[model samples]
Target: MIQKGSTLPEADFSQLKNGEMTNPKTNDLFGGKRVLLFAVPGAFTPTCSHAHLPGYVALADKIKAKGIDSIVCLAVNDAFVMDAWGKAHNADAIEMIGDGSAEFTKAIGLDMDTSVFGGIRSLRYAMIVNDCRVEMLNIEDPGRFEVSDAETMLKAL
Candidate 1:
C-alpha cells in the first residue's frame, strides 16, 4: 500500500488537450506544487459520480483557501475517459486524469485486486503531495467511502 511521505510513481501518460497529446512524467506533474489527489474505482460511477466529485466541487474555493495549488481527481481510466468525465461533471475546478493502465496506481502500490469487478481498481484514497513527497494520506476501507473526502484532506492540509 502507498504510505505517507513516499514519492509518487514515476510514470508518464498521454494528456489530451485541444486534440493534441503531451506525455508528462510523474515528477513534472507534482513538481513544486501542493496537490490534493483523490482516486476512485471508476469514473462516472455511483459514489464517485455523485458524492466524491461533488465534495471537491462544493468546496473548490474552500480547498484553495487553504493555499493548496491544485485539486486533482484521478481514476484507473484513460485520459480520454477522464477528460470526458470532467466535461460531463463540469469539474472546472478539479483536474481530472485517467490512469487507464493504473501505471501510477501500481507504482505507488495503491492497486487492489478488484478484478472481481473486472481488473484492478484504486482504493478510495486522498493524499496531500507537496513538491512530490506525500505529506499526508487518507485511505478508505473497501466498499466504503469516507476518508478521502475533500474536507478531510482540507483539514489535514
Candidate 2:
C-alpha cells in the first residue's frame, strides 16, 4: 500500500467521455492540485455501488469546498463499464477512471487477487494527493468498509 508523503506512481488511466475513450497520464491529472482518489475492486459491486461510490458522490460539493481540485473513482474495469456505472449512479461530480489492466493498482502495491471475481483487482482505498504526492491514505481491510469511506476522509481533511 502507498503511504503518506510518498510520491504517487505515474501511470495511464482510461476514461470515457461522450462515447470516446481518453487516456490520461496520472501526473497530468494530479499534478499541482489537491486530488481525492478512491479505488474499488470492481464496478457495480455491492459495497461499491451502495456505499463507497455513492458516499463520495453525496459529498462531492463539500469535498470540493475543502480545496480539492478533483474527485476520482477508480475500478479494475474497462472504460465502457465505468461509464455505464457512473451514468446509472448519477455520478457526474466524480471522474470514473478505468484501470482495465490493473497497472495502476500494481504500481501502487494495492493489487489483490480475486480470481473468483476475475483476476487481479485493486483493494478498497482512498487517498488525498497533493501535487502528485500522497498526503493521506486509507485502505480498508478485506470485505470491510471503514477507514476509506468518504465520511472518514472528510474528517481527515
Top candidate (lDDT): 2
The superposed Cα distance between candidate 1 and the true structure at residue 130, in angstroms, equals: 0.3
TM-score of 2: 0.97
Name the candidate that leads on TM-score: 2
lDDT of each: 0.83, 0.93
Span of ten consecutive residues with least summed lDDT in model 1: 13-22
Listed per candidate, the RMSD to the true structure in angstroms reads: 1.4, 0.8
Candidate 2 residue pairs in clash (backbone atoms < 3 Å):
none
Q: Point out where model 2 deviates above 4 Å.
A: none
State the local distance difference test value for candidate 1.
Answer: 0.83
Report residue 100 deviation for candidate 1 (angstroms). 1.4
Off by over 4 Å in 1: none
In TM-score terms, candidate 1 sits at 0.93
